[model samples]
Target chain A: MSHKIKGGCQCGAVRYSTDAEPMVTFNCHCTHCQQASGAPFTTAVAVQRENMTISGDVIEHTQTSDLGTLVHRFSCAKCGAYVYGISDGFGATAVNAVTLDDASWVEPQMEVYVSSAQPWTHMDPALPKFDKLPPMEES
Target chain B: MSKKIEGGCLCGAVRYESDAEPLFAVNCHCRHCQMTSGSTHIPGIGLPAAAFSHTGDVTWYKIQNDRGGQSMRAFCPTCGTPIMGQIEGEEILFLHVITLDDPGGFAPQMDIFESSAQPWDRFDDTLPRFAKMPPMGE
Candidate 1:
């Protein structure tokens, strides 16, 4: 059975819960992510938008992604901690898997946005990868 | 807190400078970074949002981050060069280090999100590292 996962914004004012298993999990090394998280790549978990339940006031910022897809960034209205994003490119919502209450359970399967990755950053040797966001061919 | 820096998008559509020192510097090894930069690690420098200054119109795009944060990427649509981004927790706009007028002036202090870095990617051994984004003040 799929496990339930819960998460919230930095201030804990915004919370979310989901019973659906993640559709996918991976790392995005794109410049946007590098700039956003101030890290090498952002670790994310994806699930259907319908499976998630959110509470509290969260602000959203929408833009057309570099891939030409619409993406919405969800954050806490008060603390501005980013909680998740919905992408037309993947037809799914990606939550910062690290923010999940049970962070230990999240597992990443692939890595995207590699082209912009830093020369020094080294990824796992086994995961499949693409220089940029790979097309969402699978569900 | 980091040294003051200056940068903007490629087309000159956006021009801004910042006095805030980077809180941290990192090299991203994710696929999106590679594609966005057409290379490995999008070496990025971070500064608090309040420390920046700019003049010029830039465009933006929102994207999904691995960590579940809302990502606002600002760039010059005309030249298609990314300028900066504003993320949730970190109270700053992430300036694309490359977009800096003097890219050589900035250097990454550490590496984060190393779990997704590529095997062949070469980075300087002198920087600090974390498997994930390190906690602040670590």
Candidate 2:
């Protein structure tokens, strides 16, 4: 079943909508994600890059991933709220789950980069945890 | 026990150091925190404002809390990394835990603002939970 989702930054300066369901959902515990979210980890919902429509002003910053791929992070210029990320390694764009208007449906299927996770940070025991990004399956 | 710690933003444009140990640590589930950090909750280490030294430029945004209190959030404009938050009329400056160079050292003793927490976000059941910020001494 497919449904539309909507969200925006804190200042309401940046908004986004997608009619596609997330292909996969996960939580990242990498150091980069920690820095990006200023939290233990960040939850992400991956959707087809072309399926999402984003509007308003956003600023982008690029960083090299642990796998040596370039990851571009986008955030609201006005409120500094992280909106999403695009990685060269992953063809899909990952939206920050916290930015979603309705987050009750978000259920991460896996935890990546668990080796870098802080000791005090907790994760769902039921979700598969990988020390690093698991080998991607062919779509 | 006391320790010195250092940290900076992703771009390294904003940096901070503190010699004083954290006065307290908490996992905040306030909506303001979720919005600013772009996460379910923010783990923070409260430090005395006077004991912290910061360098480089930061962009500050002011937000009103549920109680109509003023809150100031600061982040690095270059990297969009949240640095710290300050409650109006409060002397403590809460540093984002993940911003610390050694974030593992942080151990949250409590969870606050659980009432505003997203249903999907899980918390450690062992930690004390408060519907709101506990009284100053409690």
Candidate 3:
């Protein structure tokens, strides 16, 4: 079903909305995800970059991924809430799932970078797991 | 085993170190956590503020919790990596566990604010669970 999802930063400085159904939803356990989120992993939903619109001042931090691709993380400057990310190797922008105004609906369909998952972190056995980001075509 | 742990933000704009072992560690699933870390939840270690030392440019954002308590979250201004959080009047600072140089060493003893956890997130049954922040001593 097609619907609009809304979210914003903690301080209400940044707001975003997307009407496109997510192409994929997944959890990432790569060390970069860990550092970027200050958590064991991060949950995100990927959508067509053209389908999303964001307002307010946000800053982007670019880092080279282990796969040799550049990933740009965007966050609210006022509250420092991570909003979304863009990867040079991927066509879609990944919005941090937790930033959704109503995140209860998010259900990760897969787990990626499982090889780097922390030993103590738990994962749903029911979801498909990958040692790394699956091929772009598969996603 | 006790060991000194050190870490910094992605842009290297902020750095911190702690010599004392974590007194308590937990995975917090509160909405506040989700907003701050932009993740399902945040893994944090409660450490004595006295034992922690930080350097570089850090920004603090104050937010009032649902309970009307004031919480201050600190992050690196340049990279936006959340470094730590502190509740007003509390002596311990909750350090973002994942920010540690050796984050793999972290072992969460419990899960807190499970009531706020997202449907997609799962927690280990092995850890103690609290629907909300337990009493200070509990």
Candidate 4:
């Protein structure tokens, strides 16, 4: 169960744990995610904001996502490891998927912003893809 | 011929420019990279130290690798971007290629630290793969 999800920043300056399973998982290929994550895509694990217990200080950077929604990204104040994010665009607090202590349980539900994905990025063909965001029923 | 490479963090709070050609490019699946990038691996380019410049704030987080060498992760504080990394005593700086002004420019030639790779990670299956860090001269 994803209930055991726990992780911290690379420097251990920020640590977090959540006892609840993620409600949604997405692989975002938007340029904003690409630049922010320094990877072709970001696997975002969405969970209830109240379910997480975080220790240590974190600084938030607010930015308008490519979809024109406000997404607040957070990084460890000292180490700069991206930890998690919050946005009105979605129902839950999104954790940077790999930031989990163990991400082997992750299986992205869908791929978004495929139009902005890096040419060399290899993705699983079995997963659904979208050129941009798909119609969503935000909780 | 040398070409200039330029890029920055997502929020435009940090910028960097390099005039030297990269020595190599690869995708690293080390656990540290996974933790930092929040992705499967790091698509980075190894560049020589000279003729590189950057502006704005960057936070560096240092960690000891499985090999026991210290490598520091450099990220933008304002935007939370994984900017680059450096191994202590090493002359090269590995910059995350996805942060480039033109993210389309990255051409990764290999994969490293595969022993720690996740099962869900998918690759093109064309590049050479190393179980761990590759011998530099090879």
Model 2 Cα lDDT, one tens digit per residue, B32-118: 788887778999988999999999988888877777888899888888998899988888998998998778777899999999987
> How displaced is residue A65 in candidate 3, in Å?
2.4
Please, what are the lDDT tens digits per residue for candidate 1 over residues B1-138? 244576665335667788766776667655444434323356777777887888886655555677797666665544445456676566777676766655545567776777765544545677777776778662
Q: Candidate 1: which stretches are off by over 4 Å?
A: B1-4, B7-106, B109-138
* Count of backbone clashes, every candidate in sequence: 48, 0, 0, 0
Ten-residue segment with the worst summed lDDT in candidate 3 chain B? B1-10
Q: Local error of candidate 4 at A14, Å?
A: 1.7
Best by DockQ: 3
For model 4 chain B, the run of ten residues with the poorest summed lDDT: B1-10
Local accuracy of candidate 3 as per-residue lDDT tens digits, A18-132: 8888888899998877787787788988888778888998868899888677888887888888888887767678888888887767888999999999888899989999998
lDDT of each: 0.64, 0.85, 0.85, 0.82
**Candidate 4 per-residue C-alpha lDDT over B1-138 given as tens digits, one digit per residue, 9 for 90 to 100:** 145899888888889999889888899998888878877888999888666689998888888777688988888776678899998888889999887887577788899999988777887788899999788662
- Tens digit per residue, CA lDDT, model 2, A88-115: 7777788888888888788889999999
User: Which CAPRI category fits model 1?
Assistant: incorrect
Q: In candidate 2, residue A126 scores what lDDT?
A: 82
- TM-scores for all candidates: the values are 0.58, 0.95, 0.95, 0.93
Model 3 in CAPRI terms: which quality?
Answer: medium
DockQ of 3: 0.79
Where's the lowest-lDDT run of ten residues in candidate 1 chain B?
B31-40
State the lDDT of candidate 1 residue by residue for A1-139, as single tens digits.
5657787754567788888888778888776555444345667778898888888875555667787778776655544344677887667888876567666565668888888776646576678889986665733
Candidate 4: docking tier = medium
